[model samples]
Target chain A: MSDALYHDAILALAKDRRHAGRLDAPTHSHTSDNPLCGDRVTIDIERASDGTVRRIGHFVRGCVLCQAAAAALAASVEGRGPAAFAAAESALARVLAGQNDPENGVWAAFLPVARHTSRLDCVRLPLVAAKPVFEA
Target chain B: MTQALRSQFPILTPSLAYLDSAATAQMPLAVLDAVRAFETSSRANVKRGVHRLAEAATDAYAAARSDVAAYLGVPPSEIVFTSGCTAALNLVAHSFGALMKPGDAVLLSALEHHSNLVPWQMLAARSGIELRFLDVDAEGRIDLSALETKLDARVKLVSLAHVSNVTGSVLDVASVVATAAKVGARVLLDGAQRAPHGPLDLKTLGVDFYAFGGHKVFAPHGVGVLWARRELLDAMPPFLGGGEMIAQVELAHSTWAAAPAKFEAGTPPIGAAIGLGAACRWLGTLPWAEIAATEARLCQRLLDGLAATPGVRVLGPQSLQARAPVVSFALEGTHPHDICQIMDSAGVALRGGHHCAQPLHKRFDLAGTTRASLALYSDDSDIDAFFAGLSKVRKILL
Candidate 1:
């Protein structure tokens, strides 16, 4: 009855996932397991010479919250570099903790989880694994 | 009794659909009132104080013990109360395990919940004994055809879940008993999931030890029972050394008390025991035939709905043949934790993750699963609502 936690945009993002499957011979690939829920997510990224992300592929097996977070990051992360990921990570953390940060860009879709705290780990874990895949 | 039964469970309201009875059942009004009455009127330490209140409390506690024993079809002296099933299994591992020598093997099924498996593993690791497993088949029942090769003189004991926590498949206990008899190995059934399903006849079952938790059977928490054969209880050593389990205590040495008392050391969960007795009495009012019929109906509807749905795979026996009301299933690419959260959002309560059976999850090549187990109060609407929530999961997730 109370479906506030799972919104339309979030579900839509979860449904049409981009950058899915594996990235073979990528510059960086890391698999993270959330032992708490047995939810797994792996992120693969190929960085360009100018310190920008050229391509990103992810494999996520978990809840819609985590999947949406993964999809949100995966869909828009190619043009951004490690600096943007580093900034977004901190901003998303602040937003998820129920704080309004002007610096929190592109992670606004995750703000609803700030109200519902139990799904915080479900949403943040994949993003946590995806960030910092490339060196400055 | 069925009409009255629904109202007795206060937690069964209009909105919520509680389908996780395998974890622990919601207490009926009778159980609640019993606990309250005991705490209010007969509140005193049992068996020690000679005062009127103390004497009454001791009698009430003893009466509860008798009621529970009768419910299990055993003598009061045969049942040993512990904190819960985990404690009961631990006591068995310690007391009964002491009788085994090194190189002697303990037999277990692959589908055992962590409660039944870990204590024996600890005992085996410490005692230098080997551990063996009976494989579970694709349908999730114990493969008894392999029993001939697994059992031998070296296998001293066989422990199994009477009904699996995750799969809800009821083991063929009679077959297991007959096979273990060939090797002269003892049998113990973890009846935590079985206790709430219906009335149990442990005496006829003839297992050496039967373990169950009070909370899983509409009783209050913090109490469990270990029902053993009287001869076995008398032969084994006391698991815990404490105030109540002693006969004559000198500074140097002391003799142990009787079978039931020897295992229950220190102050027990007195109020919870009374609640458990009330729960047993409440359970007796409902006919087992009716409970079974209702469970079958609810289970069939849920299974049929899931079976017809795309990308949903029900774990364990698809039909009602050898399974309890417990059912665990997985949605393609949807983590059980995710499914559980979405279900909770729609007011359908369920359990997710390994359900304390990680090895079973590993056996099925799954990280975890979403489980919806039914109680007597569960109805056709409950199944429909659960499926309604379930239908949204794949749409929302994929």
Candidate 2:
């Protein structure tokens, strides 16, 4: 059932507020919205001169799944470069689509989300907001 | 009696308590049987064919119209069947809106569904007509106290919800009609939430237009009714142009048919229309007063249960007076989607979101709320399961 989707691990990740809020002056940021449920996710990043990520932040006005996804994404990519962020996003997408498992991280907390097809987008909104940075 | 009523809806199981009737009600056996009978015995294109099956289909369609008209207490000729409530409202907006000057206004409420509000916005953009809104009160009812200031000779229409889908606040129709009569403004009510509760008499309500969807009334989807005064229908042009809507076509021009046929362009949802007519006839047999009393009792139970909870806050009118059995509430520190997910696992179906009334949610300073709406078939078990689900939500999310 969908009840398994709200496990303690995901709830704890969602409750993690260290990465919540905007950067003082972000180098890049993007916002994505779930039109069906009116959930919004904003991902802000501060990058070094070498284009590596210095810090990551997120602001989510959405459900628990969305908040957890954003928190996990921010925690995973804080000290990494764009290539590492892309790899993390790919791993999560594969796990959510039931294609593969997340390599080794808190992303496994999102494994239950695969069964609830209606909520897959809720877990993906964070990744969607972060993609445009690499593209630019 | 509740068991017997519940049994008529084959989808209702003993373990499943559906509280999302405001979204789309489950169809009863009578309506389903009517659709099956029509499809199996006499299914054909309506209004044009000369064969025996075609004649039977045409007759059934007309009879369905008559049945629906009888339910609305209006003449069959005045009822125009559209694809759904959205289409019905759009038909009026496009056709009647074409009659307005650029400066005329259509006064609508702040609490209208997107179906009611967007079409008027589109009309305003197309015709350069002014659009005005009546403020919604703190309790979510349409505040018509200041309506006189908004009314004038320039306002052509005053459209509002008969009963709000999100808040369940029933509008004061008599007061609205009386006030609008002063400035000669026509009234249209989006009756999508109200139609499922009981039968209605448009003549007594004295409104110029009414629209409701079939799916909300236990009939099939893709069908709805738009009732208008015959004179208004006669004065307006056709919203759409197709084969059935035209009388005689030439390279240069074509003449239009009468009101109902003129509004229904292309092929209609014949089976769905037949099913809606059957549903109306079936609903006519039930005792609405008794059903209303049971619904009120169930609503009170739900309200008291929500009140008893630690963090729960009801959004609409707390009292059951002058409201449908729709209840939207917010629990502190928990999102509506999470509550709904947990509730669904507990075998209780509830809807959680803005319910297409985003402005109303914004008015209440909420992102979304969990909604439990009832129908004639809903009983005490549904409410019991609802509270049980809320208890589970408290344990898990809180």
Candidate 3:
């Protein structure tokens, strides 16, 4: 086997995501295209009474990195409030700052993403698209 | 000699499988030496130089033009050097398209690269000339039946690629020429992909214009050749006005130079022109029949290997005779970006995108396909690495 950038977990995330569809009448949804590579991703979510995410769905046409990140984001933000969103944002910032290895958190699955420093946005585009929705 | 070809390319390290020659070829040592020799020994402006160095540079530049013209079997005066193939096509679209009037139409194939398509489209929009298409089959070859049906009195031109960069499908130029003749429409062929593969004789092609990139034929960038029939060049207005392309300059109106000189505006790509000449000379020495046989073998191996893998769908003609060395395909259940990344990890460099043939990609109902093209440098080992890399993607993504 080749020394691939994607490990088993990242590939697993890419293959099948629970949030791989669009939600009808989503409370907050936004779709954006990555201008450089022309990959598109849509984030959809329903919020609970406490302003936490009730359910999430994603319609992404992108690379494995984006798809895996979308799947990871969907899985991580379940039932979490605004505090968790901020933590995820901070973790994403650290990644942009050249910290490729993050441990024991929802973002830790993205450890393999550091190799293509150029592709940082592919792993983070989902969070950027969905974060604004949760803020409202 | 074929085996020794690899050593001539410095970029072909043992581990790197550079499979993207359809995009741009790697430069050979002969070209580099020629460029270095000219730049270091006799570096001066061309054409109007009076000194020894200036005269040497001018001779070298003119010699390069003669070399390229010889490669294409055209006289030097028929060849116009341009920035690249796109510029060459645009020169025609603007210059020839000027002669076209309202109700006049141009027929193009869906298989043309954007370089050939967009220029004509722009002309059609600017002028009232109608734009038409020759239908492309699912295999990505242009339908000659459609061409016969579409050719009519109103059609002024027929422009197409000699080979489809996306599908690696070769167009039947003779049939296209015959059909266009029925309508009395002129033909302009994009030879960007075709020129690198083999020698071209303009008399045999019988097209009004043929344009190709020098970089694609293992030369340096920025130098491209446009061969137009002398009469057509004389008839068409100069695309640009500047020092070299002029005859007599007046304050208000300036007379233009003859044919090829009229099309070439400013000082040309000097070093690049010399390098391209060396590249053409190097290709001229090779046994093309032997080269074609090897390419066919390598292409078949690539296609067959891709076919063997599950979920892999090869695009274009299955027969080696029907296609160029390019192989564009999409793997089911995997995006091109994913496939490229996974393969890239294995040091297999292939292209993954629309390849600037977006209309053809749209016709295929694909966002893009991964392309792996071969050249003289390709071997059985590269094909093995490609299939091996693809299998890895299959294992992971599928």
Question: Which sections of candidate 3 miss by over 4 Å?
Answer: A1-4, A27-38, A44-56, A72-97, A100-136, B249-253
What's model 1's lDDT at B186? Answer: 94
Query: Could you arrange the candidates by DockQ from highest to lowest?
Result: 2, 1, 3
- Could you tell me the lDDT of residue B282 within candidate 1? 80
By lDDT, the candidates rank as 2, 1, 3
How far does residue B201 in candidate 3 sit from its true spot (Å)?
A: 1.3
Considering every candidate listed, which one attains the maximal DockQ? 2
**How do the residues A54-90 of candidate 2 rate in per-residue lDDT, one tens digit apiece?**
9888999889999999989988888877787888787
- Report the C-alpha lDDT of model 1 over B185-248, residue by residue, as the tens digit: 9999999999899888997897889999999999999999999999999999999898789998
lDDT scores of the candidates, listed in order: 0.85, 0.91, 0.84
- Tens digits of per-residue lDDT for model 3, B1-398: 56688889988988989888888999989999999999999899888789998999999998999989888888999999898999999999999998889889999988888898899889989898899898788777888887877889999899999988978888888888887888899999998888878888888987889999988999999989889988999999999889689999999999999988898898899999999989988888888888888888999998888888777777788887668999999888777877788788888988887788878877888777899998888887888899889887887776
lDDT of 2 by residue, B262-370 (tens): 9989989999999999999998899899899998999899889899999888888889878899999999998899999999999999998888888888888888899
TM-score of the second chain for every model: 0.98, 0.99, 0.98
Candidates 1 and 2 compared: the better one by lDDT is 2
Q: Please compute DockQ, using alpha carbons, for every candidate against the native two-chain complex.
A: 0.41, 0.78, 0.34
Superpose all Cα atoms of candidate 1 onto the true structure and report the RMSD in Å to 1 decimal: 3.2
